[model samples]
Target: MAVLGAVGGLLAALGLLAFGLYCCYVRYIHAKYDHIPGAPRESFIFGHLPILWRMLRKQEFMHDLFLQWAEKYGPVVRLNAFHRVSLMIVSPEGVKEFLMSPQYSKDPLVYGRVFSIFGERFVGNGLVTVCNHEHWHRQRKIMDPAFNRNYLIGLMETFNEKAEELMTKLEEKADGKTEFSMLTMMSRVTMDIIAKVAFGLELNALSDDQMPLPRAVTVALEGVTKTRIPFIRYMPWKQKLIKEVKESVRLLRRVGKECLDQRREDIRNGKEVTLDILTQILKGDALEETRDDENILDNFVTFFVAGHETTANQLSFTVMALGQHPEILERLQAEVDDVLGAKRDIDYEDLGKLTYLSQVLKESLRLYPPVLGTVRWLEKEHVINGVRIPGNTMLVLSTYIMGRMERYFKAPLTFNPDRFSKDAPKPYYCYFPFSLGPRSCIGQVFAQMEAKVVMAKLLQRFEFQLVPGQSFKLVDAGTIRPLDGVMCKLKPRSCAGSCQA
Candidate 1:
């Protein structure tokens, strides 16, 4: 009996030893083959979750650390987060390759649920979320006309009108203040611009009273950003929050559908379709044959979400950067003064002449790009910078870190508009504010024009200076925003003379 008991114990011990050996072989031997260079790894169970959390908490200069990692490791590094392995690619060449590759697709698991709120008929398989190659091609062909240069030029009046209203609103708010949160103000302006341009609905978010549509959209986005945390996904409260978000989405869709239905009715009654994006999208001949209402709604939601948030954040960052650098602001103001003069209205043609303003906007985008990182999943195995990446790997390209890498630019940390001047030597893949290749942002020109008009108009009436004792730190949420909000004293500038206030 004693001998039999000893044998059973010996067998259990052997089983344990074999399992440990298997684990070591998988972790040390196999991992070396699959891993990218320079990326730190976590233990087999938890992976890099703790490291990622620490980096995320630091907030300030986190991008700098990412750049350092890129420099230490090769351009491509493999990081494990909560058992999920991710590839971080920092080189401009690598970024260009991944962004341009047809094999790479946006990870729907990361973006799908929030997008599903747009309803199955309108969003279930829309252009932004659809993966089928033929569908993408067809949708792109139909959507291209809406953002064409001629179409954008036609929208300039809408842009100008919104800008004028925004200036008046700012003047009222800044009557006695020297500093205000430009982030909040710019959010309002961009929301109003998008609402008017996209839906032919005038939503004056710049006013003190919150507009219902913008408020609902803001609530929905806030909820979406919160759900991104892994811990948040497990809580019961998360389910409740998601339910609330769906309700908000329903409200937003109801509003959108009402507007769309009204327009469609008008078209049927022989009224000519307006030049708004919604009009073009809903009534365009390109999509006339497609019976997918879900796809149409998806596109609408994509435009609504993508259209305002990043642009608004970019504008706010531009203002903060301008406030910090008085010389650049003064130069921009001079250009605005020279171009627009005392005229209250600036035409679309006049926007082209604001060369210095364009440069300033370009520089701001470089320093604090709206999107810090973009992720694409490989449909097939691929080699990036001589490193073999397996299929289904998430490739994360950090624009935020790349813009600050010394290898990419001279004095990359410094905000200098001169870098974009005609004499500046620029490499092809180094600077990609709007991304590159076939999948590049189709609305780049429109976004640039809108930013220029809004910034030009604001600079004409106000001189912004950073407020004292305010903690204006980057809050890297959905887009990089100021954690405490940007507090700046705005002194109204005379349109006719120097901005002495």
Candidate 2:
């Protein structure tokens, strides 16, 4: 019996030893991109994950760290978090090659994380989260007509109306002493616009603070962001937040289901439904061999989340940037005054003439792009920027990092709108706020039009000042937004109705 026990103990010890060696191999020795330059590994087992976690814990702008690393480690840098390896690609050549080609698909590991939040299906196989090339292509092709030129041009009235509603809301608070969160206001307005335009439902988020959709969308995004943390579900103190997140996601799906059902009923009843986003989604589903009800809900939720939050973040950041630079704000206001001339409803032609205003918005996007970047999976080995990157590698392309790199922009930190002037050289492959290639955002034109209307009206009517002592730093939610919500005090401009620029 003693000999038998000794044999068993020896086997168990050997098994543990084997497991430990395997872990060491996976974490350290098995690194495929070690030849690529990067900061020294901060952990034997976790790689650079600890540093990332530390940055998250400290509420640091994590992208800023990536920017610093890019400067130190060149364009193609390596990063490891546990068994997963990613190469940060900031070089123009890498960007052009990987993003422009359809062969490089989205990394499932990167996008699949958002498919479900804590086991509740969030954006399940939606256009944004689907990694399969054929699937995404099918979805994108069907949805393209909804965002075509005439369709977006038709949305201008909805954009102007919702933006005007926002102007009305701001008038009540434009006392020069009342402090308000510009982000919250922008979020509400954009939510109203998207809900009405996409779903044909009046969310009225601008007038109603108690609206459920806006709050649910925010909570759902928080849930998505929290999923990035390893074992976050197992944390003791996060139970309340986790529960809230689940509930929010469920609520969003429930709303989506109800909206889809109602739209289907409307179609059956021969109701004259406009060719809106929901209609496009239903039309897409009809063309498929087998209908996917969950995928439909996935798109429903996806549009609501994507259509609203990103533009809100963009507008809020633009407001924050303009508030900080009064001279730029003055110039923008002058242009708005000259073009708009107290015209409450801005025409499509007016948008073209707001050239400086366009520059200001473009510059704001360069500095504080709401959608930072994307991830692609490289299936085969490729040499980029004089470095041989291994196949089956996950590549991270960060607009946040590239936009701030001195190699790409002159005075990377400065908020200079002239960089986007008509004569200025366009950023080759470094600047893609809406991304590039076929997978680029379909709502780019829609978003920009809505932003212009809102911003143009804001410049026309209000003179806003940044509130003192608030952190102007960004918070990297699913999309980056002003950490402080862009607190501001506003007063109606001296020439609110008309200005002789």
Candidate 3:
């Protein structure tokens, strides 16, 4: 009994020692970052994690909290969650230096979350999630052809076709009384377009409301967002959602594999394959010594999700913004009418003529960027906006936060597409909805072209008004989107010289 008592006493002493060491470690971590400005810590050990948890529970976007910090602390604000320290830097110089340079790779912790959703392989080593510069470069080089000028122009027909289908669907609901979710319609159209254009597979998401793919995409993306919540997979309440996300990912990859195998068989059979995204993906794989099928699927899922979700959200928010500001909507409609009067199909040249439409899209992105922000892992010590940031840190670059800052834009909260007018002084490194530099979104042009075609057509054919009492708040579900899905009532426009077809 005495020996056992002594052993228990020694264990108690060791426990106390460990607790002391942990306290010291937390203090050390906080001290290292104490110089940088940030919110007051609510917990010595947790380091603002409780505040973050509260925000998450409220379903508030994490960026909004960062925006509050940015407002208080200025351009370089420190963020601490447990042992992790991040610097949310929006200074133009910092944005340019970090995002433009390939040396600052993507943060492994952040991107690695999407690599596997609930321990199931998802977008593993895809271009967006890959941190290795060399590997991403090789994949990007192969994928470049799919987004080339000529290739994108070739996709114009697909864009027009898909957008027209959406118009048809909207026309049925254009009684001015039928309420519907514009986001749902836009998501469907974009999904159909990507599925058809990228893989030559017909998902028909626009026509088929019962399609499983759209739901899977949404669930999978929600999983991506939920992964940000620490220990979410281990949470008992989230287990159902966790299982759903894993299943969604599995479904997506299974579909991707089927498409990939069919494409490979076509190539083997000497079939003439067009330079679609899947072809580019397979070509990239062919160049490798041994093809990593998972990597190919990664790009497949990446393109499918990134290609559709961002553009769909952009369209929905643009619609939401235009609905709120009728005068802007009127001006946009006039521009669309002038540019595409009595025209069923929009030409590639026509996209440039709709300049106000371009401004509206840019403004919408500023206010409602679907992807929100990107994170970079800075290996070397750096000074940003007079703030000395230590090495081995995660640097968060937020377009959403910067675009809304008074320092960047006068009357920032005001919806003003004129902010992007031709004569207006261009925003220098402050406005990057598609991000900037070498690792910027490859499909920027492709996305914009598709957006213009859709928006222009929607404006030409229908007048939409926001449904009453719907929340305008944003939701961060992997991508930032309107929480209420931009519910709207639409009426077919009967203006002079309007295209009926």
Candidate 4:
């Protein structure tokens, strides 16, 4: 009995020592951002975690939650996730400093999530997710010419062709009664555009229902979003999910490999190739060090994924906002008619001429940016708005939150396209739908151009109204899109030459 008692006493002492060490470690982890303000912590171990998880589970607007925290804790709010800390910055000076400079690299852990999915390298070193600064520079330099004005202008035909296909599909249900998800329609059209224009393959997703590629891409993206939650990998019942995700990943990579190989063979055989992204990827292949076959396929998947979903969501948001605001809708339609007229194909110059449509698109992005924001990891400590940001800290620069803040936008909740008119002063750091600086989305011009073509055609051909009892809320599944998919009932436009909403 005495020996057992002594053993218990020693165990207690060891437990006390371990508890003391844990306290010290927790303090050390939190000391980095103790100075920054934030919502009151729930617990040191899971600072602000319970609230975030609750929000996620309830399908609440996580971006709005960020704005509320910013309002309570001031512009620079520090948030803790497990042992790591993330600082949310909304100030213009800080956004400029953090995003404009090359010194602040992307958070590899966050980006590295995109670098793979379920133990598979998915976007492997692609331009959008690659963290190596020098490697990204080499890839970007070679691909810049493809997105240049001359090249995008050449893509106008592909845009019009795919969008017209969508119009034909919409016509079947354009009887002024049937409700369809406009986002579903737009998603198909945009994916088709990416496949045809960027990849030189006809996806025909707009007209076909059984395209395995589209479903594979969707499943793969869902897998990417799942990877964000670290615990999902260990869920005992997720074996089937793991299999589907892996199959989806392998399917995309296998298809990408075939495309890459065929294109390479064509180039070698002296066969003509279109001026598309595949061509640019081949051109970049001249740099032998970066020309690994897997690397080439990484870009193939990267462009297809990034180039499709975001624009579809943005187009759907613009349509939703327009359906809500009749006056703005009328103005956009008038502008589209005046600029595009009865012309089947919209010229690149006419795109700039549709000024009101441009404003509407910008306004839509402000409220519902497809990509809410991006993250950066600063190399050293810095101060912004008089608050010290620690070195090696994860920073979230959220355009979605900033767009709705009263300080950044007047009457922030209202859907006002006039705010983005040419006469209206430009938002400096508060607006970045395509992001800002060197790391901005490479497909910006291509995306906007495609949007104009589709938006203009939709206005010219049909009048759309949102289905009743459907709430317009945002859903964040890797990217932010309308939760309800923007259901709409369409009527064939009676007055194509001069339609008024």
- In model 2, where do residues sit more than 4 Å from their true spots? 1-15, 27-31
Give the runs in model 4 whose Cα sits over 4 Å from its true position: 1-20, 498-501
Candidate 4 per-residue C-alpha lDDT over 1-501 given as tens digits, one digit per residue, 9 for 90 to 100: 999999999999999999889878878978878989988888878888888788877888777888888777867998887678899998888789888988788899889887788988788889988888998898999899889998889999889898889989999999999999999889899999998888888878877888887778778887876675559889888778878888988888888888888888898999999878998998888776644888888899999888998999999999999999999888877887777777777788888898888888999999999998899997788889999888888999999988988998999989998898878988999899888899999999999999999999999999999998887988777788898989999998888744432
Worst 10 residues of 3 by lDDT: 492-501
Q: Give the candidate order by descending lDDT.
A: 2, 3, 4, 1
- Cα lDDT tens digits, model 3, 413-455, are 9999999999998998888888888899999999999999999
Q: Give candidate 1's error at residue 52 in angstroms.
A: 2.2
Error of 3 at 61 (Å): 2.8
The candidate with the higher lDDT, 1 or 2, is 2
How well is each residue in 1-501 modelled by candidate 1, as lDDT tens digits? 999999999999999998788677556643644656755565665565666667665665465666778778758876665435677887777877888777677776655655554232224555656666576777677778888888888888888888888787777767556456777777888888888888777777887565766666666766655655566646886777666666777777677677777888888899977677687667543446655555566677767767887888888888888878888888888888888876666788888899888888888888888777667877677876788887767777777777877888788889999988878887456567777766677778989999988888788877777777766567666566667567767667754433332
TM-score on alpha carbons, each prediction:
0.87, 0.97, 0.97, 0.95
lDDT for model 2, please: 0.90
Q: What is the lDDT, from 0 to 100, of the residue 42 in candidate 4?
A: 88
Backbone clashes counted, model 4 = 0
Assess candidate 3 and give its lDDT: 0.90
The predicted structure with the larger lDDT, 2 or 4, is: 2
